[model samples]
Target: MNNAAQYDTVIVGGGPAGLTAALALTRYRHRTLVAESPAAPRNAASRGVHGMIGLEGATPAEVRARAWAELDAYGLTERRDTTADDIAPAPEGGFRTMLGDGTQVWSRTVLLATGVIDIHPDVEGFAACWGRTVIHCPFCIGWENADRTWGLVADDADYAAMAATGFRAWSADVIAIAPPGMDRAEETQRALRAAGSDLVQGEITRLHHHDGDLYAVEMADGTLIDRQTLLWAPPQRQVPLVTRLTDTLGLALDDDGFVTVGADQQTSIPGLYAAGDLTTAWEQGAMNAAGAGARAADAVHFAHPA
Candidate 1:
């Protein structure tokens, strides 16, 4: 609770987006502070992040470590085990943020890189296999699980169609498992059939696992479908921290509950910016985060020219 420490910009959440933002601002000689909550929530369920240059196959932890190391080299300040509880507009055209430990930081600007969380299915044993055999996003994990027996566990027909496109490049044995009476579009059905995927209609009651490995899926009728990998889409919800802060600061959110930002990553609220998954619907990793962070930092610099 050191109120004496102030910064030109305070970034909440030290994931890829926040870390990148901190690095960019510090490189520009802007005094920046990053408050990161400890590791607790589950992020992308993959061993390594994909589509990122240079560190393409690095794990999330590895990417974060490398980025933090670089930030440290640049003399950026970081405070771990801290959380931002509230943010209000400062009278001097900035922001006043209160931390969970009762520390207050007054910054000329604030960056909300707080990411989102995925809501997994309630099926038994599903949580245990997540990030290993049970995963989401084919772009990130499909290459690793390529040519293996993959199952698409989805509740909606539209999701099944989208999954079809993403999984097509990985394996030809992709199966769309949905509940009975869920009719799929002709285009999707044709694509599934053309891709040699079976349309499995059943009510999945549970997931069977062994030693952290997914073994099979059990349907309500007692039928077991054995598979090496299970891919499914999770209903995503914005992590509460970002939404609450956006509400407190009167920032605008899009229809899907993501923070609405302009091209420069500046939100409707002046001096408050957002980036990464909190601002975009596309799948993003370290590269996207870095790009967005640079954009937001540039905008902040333009707005607050010294």
Candidate 2:
């Protein structure tokens, strides 16, 4: 058998959460290996990392590169641009991970910074407008585009109504475009109208954009509505690694498909941890992911006191 290389921790991602956790461990002088996936990051479509102070408006790639650049200075953390193919509990109370290149590494603990996958609508122009004009969270990208015409394209009537009504703080012109056959509660409909939001029912055909900026939404009936941005919070699925872990290790997942974690980011399995959008459905931004990573790192560091 090949000798298993060991480290204090192995982070299964290299995005905001994984990089943040690696930084914390390096600060504490812990030996770590960050196995970043070869796949494109979840936020690659995002224009920039929003609502994160000190690093506001930075591109996702820029944020990750900046963090990874700091690793050389510490010399305590190692990085590999490879995916973690398999992870299994070690016989001696640690973990054995297989990299994409078939290298095996053992670690005392594993941090699953693997993020979630955002699902987008199946329509033309949505891809081009995504991250630039089509956004998911208002709080994350609303402030910059305030006062502009906004469209909430949601399948759930309750969420559509709530978002349309709630977005009034950002703009006076808010519209809830519900999918065909979706019905809203009377109370929600009243609230939307009271908030001065126009509610429309139709199948979104396409989002028209000019010069990469969103301009309007075209419906199946060929009706065009002028709008600058679309608030589309699509359902997200766990990354392959997270799903595999849940199946193989029996990690508990909440109804929303997020891995359940405690106050310190530890997963249902002891010594195994998770953070970022993979852990929650709300407050999922770069800043929150970084904070969660730091917290998870602290728990891992303190648990293995030197």
Candidate 3:
């Protein structure tokens, strides 16, 4: 392998976590290679990032652009716009990663910031309106769509109840749709009714949209709910690369399939770490992921210091 192809750290996924880690690793003068797939990011369709100071309302593409530029200025980190096909601990030391383009790179440590994939409901127009009009994070999109028709789709009655009531702060016209066969708790029902939120009991048959803009939702009972924005709380899973890594490298995972890591962000396997959404179930945001990435970079830096 060429010297240029050998890095002290190989970070997978070019989202905020991996990119931020790259910035920190290279700032410490470590040779870092960030392998980012060309696929669309989780928040690609969102108008802007929210809650983060100084970067409020910045688009995902803008964040990545700035990050890659900064990393380039350091001249220690390189980016490969390709997916990591496979990874295995090398016999000599460290790990070897095969890129989707058939190139192999060796690194002293590996960080998986590959993130997660939201398992959206297979409802018509739901996938098309994701990130655009249908979003999961209330903090991310609530302020902008405030006072508009809001719908919360969830299986848990407590969650639906809380979301329906809490969303009243954003819009008085909040609706909670509990899945079929699940009874709403008495307290939950009381909360929704008190908040003046409508409770619908049925499966979402389809989301109605036109010209890529969402307009309404159709329930199984043929009831059409006029909703411009939807607060979709769907289950999410680790990306395929993380799954493969956990299997091939004997890495430990939580019951929810997220990679288990310590406070240092180190995974079960030595010289391997995980950060961002793939490591936590709560607080899945770009800013949070970036902070985790920086912390993971610290762990990697201390582990393999010059």
Clashes of each: 0, 0, 0
Task: Give a tens-digit lDDT track for model 3, residues 1-306.
Answer: 444278899999998899988888888889998999998888787889888788888998998898888888879888888999988888778999989988999999999999999887778888888886787887778788787788887678877876555776788787777876676555566778787776777788898988557798898889998988888868988788788877777789989788899999999999998889999877788888999999999989998983
Candidate 2 ranges with C-alpha deviation above 4 Å: 185-187
Candidates' lDDT values, in order? 0.77, 0.85, 0.84
For residues 1-306, what per-residue lDDT tens digits would candidate 2 score against the true structure?
A: 258888999999988788999999989888999998777887888777877778888988888878878887899999888999888999888899999978999998999998888887798898888777788888777887798889888777667776555777888788888877776545556777887776777888888899658888999999999999998877889878788888898999998789999998999999999989899989688889899999999999999742
Best by TM-score: 2
Q: Tens digits of per-residue lDDT for model 1 on 1-306? A: 234456789898887788878887887888888877775635645578778778788877887788888888878566556888788887766888888787888888889887778787788988888877887666767787788788987766777765456666887676778777776645566777776666678888888889658778899999999887888766777776677866665778888777899998999988899888778666455568668888888888788752
Instruction: Please give each candidate's TM-score.
Output: 0.89, 0.94, 0.93
Give the local distance difference test score of model 3: 0.84
Q: Which ranges of candidate 1 are over 4 A from the true structure?
A: 1-4, 44-46, 162-166, 180-191
Sequence-dependent TM-score of model 1? 0.89
State the local distance difference test value for candidate 2: 0.85
**Lowest summed lDDT window (length 10), candidate 3:** 180-189
- List RMSD in Å for every model shown: 2.7, 1.7, 1.9
Worst 10 residues of 2 by lDDT: 180-189
Ranking by lDDT: 2, 3, 1
Evaluated at residue 13, the lDDT of candidate 1 is 81
Q: Give the best candidate by lDDT.
A: 2
